[model samples]
Target: MSPDRANPPETSLTREFLAALTTFGAMGYVVVVNPQILSVTGADRHALIVITALAAIVGSLFMGFIGRLPIALAPAMGTNTVFAMAVAGSGVSYGTALVMVLVGGIVFTLFSASRLREQVVMAFPEAIRTGLQCGLGLFIAKLGLMGGGLLTRDGHFGDLREPSVMLAGAALLATPVLLALRVPAALLLSIVAVTLIGLLVPGAHGDALTHLPAAPVQMPPWPSDYTFAFDFGSFMNHLALALPLAGYFFLGDFFSATATLIGVTRRAGLMNADGKLPNARAAYLADGLASMVGSCIGSPTIAAYVESATGVETGGRTGLTAILVAILFTFAMFFWPLIAAVPAQATTPALVMVGVMMMEGIRHLDCSKLENTVSAVLIMLLTVTTGNLVIGLAAGSFAYTLMALALRIRVAPVLLLTDLLLAVYVALSALTLHH
Candidate 1:
C-alpha cells in the first residue's frame, strides 16, 4: 500500500490532455527534423512527411489509448540521423534501416517489459545519471545553435552570434516568463511567442517572416512502401556500426524518458513515496512504440521532451494535456505552413535555454565525489566536443566503469549492468571506426 494508492485519481480529461501534450512535444521533433532526413535518404520529402505524420498519429494513438501512458511516439532524432547519415549512408537501404530500427525498438520494448530494464538502471551511479542529463542539455543547446545558424562553421565552432543572440534571448526570456506565470501549453506558447516577436521585429535578415517551401507531401494509402527488407549480409559487416548505435540510442532515449518522467511527476506533485506514478509503464511503453513506428514512416525515434516539464510545472497532473497535444498535432499537419513559418531563429533560443535549464538536475549530484566528477566531466567534454549524445554517454560510461573497477567501488547491480551495456557500445563503436 503506497501513498499513491491512498490518493484520489486524477480526472480523466486532465489525464488525457497531459498525455496528448506530452505526445505533442514528442511530435514536434518530427516536424522539425524529418524533412532533413528525407533529403539525405533520396526519399521523397512529401511522402516522408505524410507517412511520418501518419506514423506519429497512429503510433501516438496506440500509446495513448492502448498503453495508457503520457508517452508520445515519434521518430527519434538521434537514431534517424544515425540511420540516414551513417548506417544507411553506407549503402543500407532506407527500408533496411527501417527494419533495423524496428529491431532496436523490439529489443528496447522487451527490456522495458522484462526485469532487464531494472538491472540496467541499477548499474549506473547517480553521478553518471546527473552527468548524462547535463550532457543532454549541452547536446540540445548545441543543436539549437546549429539549427538557428548561430554556430555555422565559417572556420571553427563558427560565430557565436549572428541572428542567434536575438532568437536565443527571446526564447531564454519567454521560457522563464512562461514558467513563472504558470502558462498552459508553455512549450508551444513559448515557441509561438518568440515566432510572433520574430515576425513583428525586423530580423537580422530583414525578413519579417520566412516561409518554408510548400509541398503537399502525400503517402500512398496502399502499404506498398512497407518493406521488411534487411540485408543480413550487410548487417553482419555493419554490425559493428549498428550494435553501438542500437545500444547507445536505446539507452539515451530510455534514460532521458525515465528521468524526465520522474522529474515531471514530482514537479506536478503526483509522485508517491517511492517516486512512482500509477501509469509509469504506460509512459515507458509509449517511447518504445514511438521509435518503432517512426522507423517505418522514415522518421527517427521520438522520446519524451525535457521541455514538457513546463507543462507539468503548470499543474498538468493528468493525461488530458497529452491528449490535447495529440489533437493539436493532428491539426498542425493541415497547417504545416504555419508551423513552417516559425523561423529557426525564433526556436533556437528556447532550445538553447532548455539546454541550460536541464542542468539544474545536476544540483542533486555530488560532483565532489571522485567517480561522479570523472563521469560528469567526461560526459560534458565529449558532448560539447563531439556534439553526439550517444558518443558522450558511451565515453562517460566507459570512464565511470573503469574508474569504478580501478577503485573497487561497489556500485548497484543496475549501475553495473548499465556500465556493461555502455562498455559493449563503446567496443562496437571502436570496431566500426576501425573497420
Candidate 2:
C-alpha cells in the first residue's frame, strides 16, 4: 500500500459535524459564562455576539487551516471579568480597554510569530510545563466553583451552602451519567438536562435558568467608535492597570493555549515522526489573532478552551473538528438566548470534571526530585487558592529556580527572566492586593 493511501481522511464533513458538536459540548462553560459577562459590562449583547463569532472564525482559521490543530478560541472567562468589573468600572471606557487588549494581541502576535512563544514554552523543564497545565486545570475548576456559587463569599468566614451545594451536586452527577450513557456532547447535554430539571422540578435555587433558542448569526461591525474607538487619554488613565491585564491575561492565554494544544496533539497521536508538536508558530499565531479579534469586538480576550480537550478524547484528530466546532459556535451566536439558559450550577460540574482530567499532569512530576515536586505542588496550590495564574506561575518559578540553583543544576537565563517577572508581580500583589 502507498504511504499516502495509508493516511486517514482528515476532512470528512460528517466527522467534522460530530467533532464540532463535541467541541461545542466542551465549550459549555464559556457559552454560559460570557453572556453574563457582557450583561454586566453593559455592552450591547448583539455586538458581543458579533465579536464572539468573529473570534471563533478568525481563531478557527488560524488553528484548523494555519496551525492544523483542533482547537477553538473565544473570550476567556477570568480576563473578561477583570475587564468588566475592574477595568471598565475604574473609568477606562470600553473602547480604550479594548485598545489595551489589541495591544496585548499585537505583543502576543509578535512574540508568537517569531516563535519566541514556543521558545518560552520550551525553556520550562518538562515537569514545570506539565505542572502549569495541571495548575490551569485546577484554576478552571475553581472558577466553576466560584461561578456556580458552590464557593461563595461568607462574612469573615466562608462556606458552601444549600443551593450552591444542590446545583453543583446536580451538575457533577449529570456529566458522568451522560458520559457513561454514551451521550454525544455529554458535558453540554448534561448541563442542559440538569438546568431543565432544576428549573421545572421545583425549588430551583441560585441563578435561575432561562430557556434559550438558536438565533441568527450577525457580522462583526467595522472597527469603529462604538466597537473600535480608542481614546488615547483613557488609555493613559489605565496604563498602570494595563500591565496587570497584560501580564496575567497573557499568561492565562499562554497557559490555556499550551494546555489546549498539548491535549489535542497527544490525542491525535500525530506525533512528529520525532514525537514533537507541529507547526507551533502557526498555532500560536492563530491564538494571538483570535485575541486580537476578540478585543476588537469589545469582549474579553480569547484563549483555547479545556473543553476542546474532550473532543480530542472523543477521537477528534483533524482541523475539521475545529471547523465543525466553529460552525456550531456560529449557530450558537443566534441562539445566544437559548444557550444562555444553563445555570452556573449545571455547568460547574463539567468544569470540575475537566479540572480532574487536567490534574493528571501532576502524575508526571517526580516529588522525589525535590525541585520538581516543590514546583508542581506550589504551582497547583497557588493557582487554586489564589485564583491567579500568573501569581501561581511566579511562585512556582521562584521555587523552581531557587531549588535549581541550590541543587547546582544548570538552568537557562530565560528561566531566570521568567522567575524575575513572576517575583516582581507576586511582590506587588502582596503589598497592594492589586492582584
Candidate 3:
C-alpha cells in the first residue's frame, strides 16, 4: 500500500469528538455493567460506578497523551470475574484482591517497557492462548446466569416464576437483536430497557420486579472514598496464595491489552510494514499504569478496549479522539445513582453477549494440530464444569506441556516454568481447601 493508504488523514477536532462519541456509544455500557459485575464481591456498587468511570477517564487520557492512539480503556471482563469469583469468593477479601491486581499491573508495566514484552509475546503457545480466552468466556457466561438468579447456586435453573428472573431472560434474548440492528450503545440500552421494565411492569406478585433505590440521582463519589483502600498487609502475609492470583491478573491483562491494541491499530492502518505498532512500549505502559490506577480506585484491570475500533473506523486518526473519550467518561461519573440502580438481571445480557464474543476465539485453534487442540478444548470444558479460572488454567497448562512433549513439539522454556508454577499453585490451593 502507498504511504497515503497506509495511514489515514488527520481528523479535524469536530470529527475526532464525533468519533469519540461513537466510541463511547459502543462501550459506555461498562459504566453500569462493570459495577454490577464487581459488586458481587461485596464492594459498594455506588463507589464502584464512580471508580469505573474514573478508570476509563484516566485510561483514555493516558492512551491519548502518551500512547497517542485513539483507543480507550476500562476494566476488562475476564480479569474482573477472576477477581470477583475465583479470588474474593474463595475467601480472599476484596481489599487483598485489589492488592493482587496492583502487583500484577506493576509487573506488566515493567515488562511492557522493555524487550521482555516481545520475548513474552513470542513465548505464548497458540493452544494455551486460545484456550485461556475461550475458557474465560465460559466462566463469564456462568457468572451471568448465576448473578441474574436464572441459575441456582448448584447450577440448577432457578424458579422461572420469579418476575426478576423472567425479565432477565427477556433481556438475554433482546440484546442480540439490538446488536444485530447496529444500535448505538446497544448493550447499555438493553440494560436500561430491562431495568425500566423491572421498575414499571408488575407481575403476579402485584409489584414491579425490582425494588426502588433510595433515589435516582446523587453526587458522584470522591476518589478519597477508595484511594489506597487495598489491604497490603493481608497480601504481604499471604504471598504464596496472593502471587498466583497476581499472575492471572498479569497474564490476562497482558494478552487482552496487546491483542486489542494490535487489532485496533491494524484496522486503522497504523501498523508499520514490519507489522510492529508504533510507540508500542508507550501504549503498553499506558495500559499497565491504567490497571494499577484502576485497582487503587476500586476497579479491576483497565486496558485498551476493542470497542475503540468504532472510533477508528469512524475516522479517528489522532490522540484527540481518545482525549474526547476521556472527557465523556468524566461526565458519566455523575450518574452513579442511576447506574447503581441497574439490577444484575439487567446487566446479565451484556455479560452473556460478551462471553459469546470471547468464545469466538475458539476458532483460532488449529484442528490439524491435534495435540494443541486438546489443550484448548480441555481448558473450556474444565472451566465451565468447575467454575474456577485458576483450576482450568493450571490443569490445562500441565496437559498442554505433556502433550507437546509427547508430540515431539518444542515447548518454550517459559511455558515449562509456567507449568512448574501452576503445579505449585495447585498444590497450595489443595492444602488451603483441605484446611
Q: Write the per-residue lDDT of candidate 3 for residues 233-308, one digit (tens) a residue.
A: 9888777667777887888888888889889989988886678886688889999999888888877888788999
Off by over 4 Å in 2: 1-11, 36-54, 68-70, 76-104, 125-132, 155-167, 180-182, 201-226, 229-241, 244-259, 262-266, 269-279, 305-318, 426-435
User: Candidate 1 at residue 292, lDDT?
Assistant: 73
Residue range with the least summed lDDT across 10 consecutive positions in model 1? 215-224
Residue 102 in model 3: lDDT = 93
Ranking according to lDDT, highest score first: 3, 2, 1
Model 3 accuracy (lDDT, Cα): 0.82
| Residue-by-residue lDDT tens digits, candidate 2, 1-435 | 322225643556665666677777767446655554555566665455556666666677667776666677778755665566444344457777677677777778788878568666666776677666787677666656766666654412223445545656667776777767867667666667777765643334434443444452333344343455656677766555555556556655776677677767767675555555666677888888888777765656788776666677666777777777777766666665555455556767776766676776667777778888888778778766755555666777788888899989878876786666656655655666554
Residue 364 error, candidate 3, Å: 0.8
Candidate 3 backbone collisions, by pair: none
User: Which candidate do you rate higher for TM-score, 2 or 3?
Assistant: 3
Candidate 1 lDDT, 1-435, residue by residue in tens: 546547744655655565455546533645544554444577655455555566567655655565444444455444455555543335566665666676667777777677677567656677777776777677666666666666663424534444545565556566767656755545556666666766565556666645444652322333346434445566556654555556556766777667767766776677766766556666667667777766655555566655446555444555455555566667657655455566666666556655676688788788677878888878878866765555676777777777888888876765555556656656766776799
Error of 2 at 300 (Å): 3.7
Candidate with best lDDT: 3
Model 2's lDDT to the true fold?
A: 0.65
For candidate 1, give the lDDT. 0.61
Query: How many times do residue backbones clash in model 2?
Result: 7
